[model samples]
Target: MVTGGAGFIGANLVRALGEVPQVSEVVIVDDLSTGLLDNLDGLPARLFQGSVLDPDLLDDALAGAASVVHLGALGSVPRSIDQPLQSHHANATGTLMVLEAARRHGVRQVILSSSSSVYGANPVLPRQEGLRPVPVSPYAVSKLAAEAYAVAYSACYGLPVLPFRFFNVFGPRQAAHHAYAAVLPRFVTAALAGEPLRVHGDGRQTRDFTFVGSVTSVIVDAIVRRVTTTDVVNLAFGARISLLDLIAELEDILSRPLPVVHEPPRPGDVRDSQADCSRLRELFPSVRPVALRSGLEQTVSWMSGHVLTGH
Candidate 1:
């Protein structure tokens, strides 16, 4: 069973999973909170309309599934800042419901789509799986709490679950204007529209932007192999790109000039972050992630051809 299977990453995973010969049944449950209906267009899966917080609905979804991939959550840092209580309930409480349901159903494997924001304010380079968490925002706090639950449940109940701490993931189908949209999509939309490309704090803040394809591959491999890594694995490209450089690359990709809109750094914002994915290497030995430039080019092309043209 896949929760939030209609969002950017989730939708992509559904498409990928459909191509697997061994997979005959795929069940998708989503509330459509931030996910788009268009993402589910070609998917061949049993669809259920419900929130992860609904225990009755969750129980129904978890029943009879061999495993569960929990990707549903409130996904924006700024949105969390604006509405802390709502974000907490959706991400933290929602995750607990999924884990509990999976445990009760005797599911073999669970893969959580965690975040890199959990390394907040640590001033750390290439965040490792073993580092002490210092989440900066309510969103990050919620993810960290969910990770704890996944780990505790693993140790206490022996439920095999793997958590992937993703870093700056971006690709097609990402909502550009949603309250919690990732920064890359928003910037691409602004750039394509020839509007002011907003930059917070001099645009020097760096991030390890992992491609969505690579992220999905890692998750699928983890699930297929029933990966036994106890610690939350870092899913990233192991390279950092500054926001200024990112904008430049986007402008180059778009073949246009980008205007600038400077703003004060928002609260709960981290200075810099990258992922140390050696642990992911150990878990999935054959999975080599793609580079940022190539990934960005592919994403920008898709957005321009599809989203921008409205075709």
Candidate 2:
């Protein structure tokens, strides 16, 4: 069962899981809050439209499921800053509900979709799981709390759990026009439309952008291999790219200069973020992240088509 399966990463994961030979069926549960039903179009999966907070829905969805991929959450820092209570309910409380449901149903494994935001402002060069988490925003705090819950559940109930601390993830199907849209998608969408690419602060903020396909690959590996250990690993390319440099690369890909609009840095925004993916490599030796330039090219191609189709 893939919670939030209609979402960006979740939707891509659904597609990837369909290709696994051992997988027989994929059940998707989503509230469609930020997730679109169109994202799951033509995908072979059973769709259950509901929130993870609903106990009945969770119980029904987890029935006979061997593993559960919990990705349903209120996932934006700025949005969480504005609506902390909602963020807490969805991210923190929602995770607890998922854990409880999985435990009751005897689910073997639970894969949690955590974030890099949990390492907020920790000045650490490459964020490692061992580093103390100092969450800046409500969103980060919620994800950190959820990770703690996963750990506690694993230790207490003997339910195997794997929490992945993902950095900036971008690729096809990532919504661009939304208020809390990711940086890369928004930049690519505006650039394709010949509009100014908005840069918060001086655009020097660096991030480790991992492609969605690479993320889905690790997820599938975890489910297929039934990884029993309860561990949190960072999933990223282990490379940092400044926002300014990212724009320059985008301009190169588009073969045109993109106008820039500077805005004040939003609260709870991290300055620099990179990952130490050594643990991920140790667990999944075959994992290889897509290159930034190459991933950007693929993203631009997809965004260009979307723009052309007025989607």
Candidate 3:
């Protein structure tokens, strides 16, 4: 079972699971808040339409499930800044409710998606899970609380939970129409529309952007192998790219130069982020992440057909 299965990563994972021989059934629970039903259209996964905070719905969803991947969170640093309470309730509290339900159901594995943003204000180069998190924003605090709850559940009740600190994950189906859309998707959409790509702060801020396919492959492999770890895992390879570099690659893929617009840096934003993936590599040795350029090309193709830019 997957929570937030109607969203970008969740939908991709659901599609990937359809191909596996070991998987007999796939179930997803999501409230259609940000996750569009269109994302799951024609997919072979069963849907339970509700929020993870709904304990009754969670009770129903967790029944007879082999495992649950928790990805249903209110994501956005700036939004969380404005609505910290809502973010906390939906992310931190919602995760607690899911963990409780999974525990009651005796689920085999509880794989939770946390964020690298939890490492906020730490000023650590190449974030490791062991480094103490110094969260600056309310969103980071909420995610930290969520992951901490997962880890605590693992220790206290012996729940098999693997918490993942994901870097900037991007690929097809990632939404870019919103004001808080991810950098890659936003850049792609603007470029497609012949609009200047908005660069937050300088174009020098770096991130380790993992493709969604690589992430899904790891999750599918974990389910197949019944992999469980008490430790938090970093979910991106070590390659770091600045925003300017990302634009350069996008320009190469499109075979055209794109204009740029500089914007003031938003509050509670990190300077840089990269994941130290030694632990992830040790866990899933067979997976190779899609190159950023390849992933960007795929994303551009997907977006041109899907999203109507400058409409």
Best by lDDT: 2
lDDT of 3 by residue, 221-301 (tens): 999998899899999998899999999999999999999999999998899998899999999999988988888889888
TM accuracy, model 1: 0.97
The Cα local distance difference test for each model comes to 0.86, 0.92, 0.91
By TM-score: ranked, best first: 2, 3, 1
- Backbone clashes for every candidate come to 0, 0, 0
**Best to worst by lDDT, what's the order?**
2, 3, 1
Tens digit of per-residue lDDT, candidate 1, span 8-34: 899999998888776678898899988
Query: What is the TM-score of each predicted model, taking all chains together?
Result: 0.97, 0.98, 0.98
What TM-score does candidate 3 reach? 0.98
Q: Which residue pairs in candidate 2 have backbone atoms (N, alpha carbon, C) closer than 3 angstroms, thus clashing?
A: none
> What digit string (tens of lDDT, one per residue) describes model 2 on residues 111-163?
99899999998999899888989899999999999988999999999988999
What is the clash tally of candidate 1? 0
Model 1 Cα shift for residue 4 (angstroms) = 0.6
The true-versus-predicted C-alpha distance at residue 52 of model 3, in Å, is 0.6
Which scores higher on TM-score, 2 or 3?
2
How far in Å is the alpha carbon of 295 misplaced in model 2?
Answer: 0.8
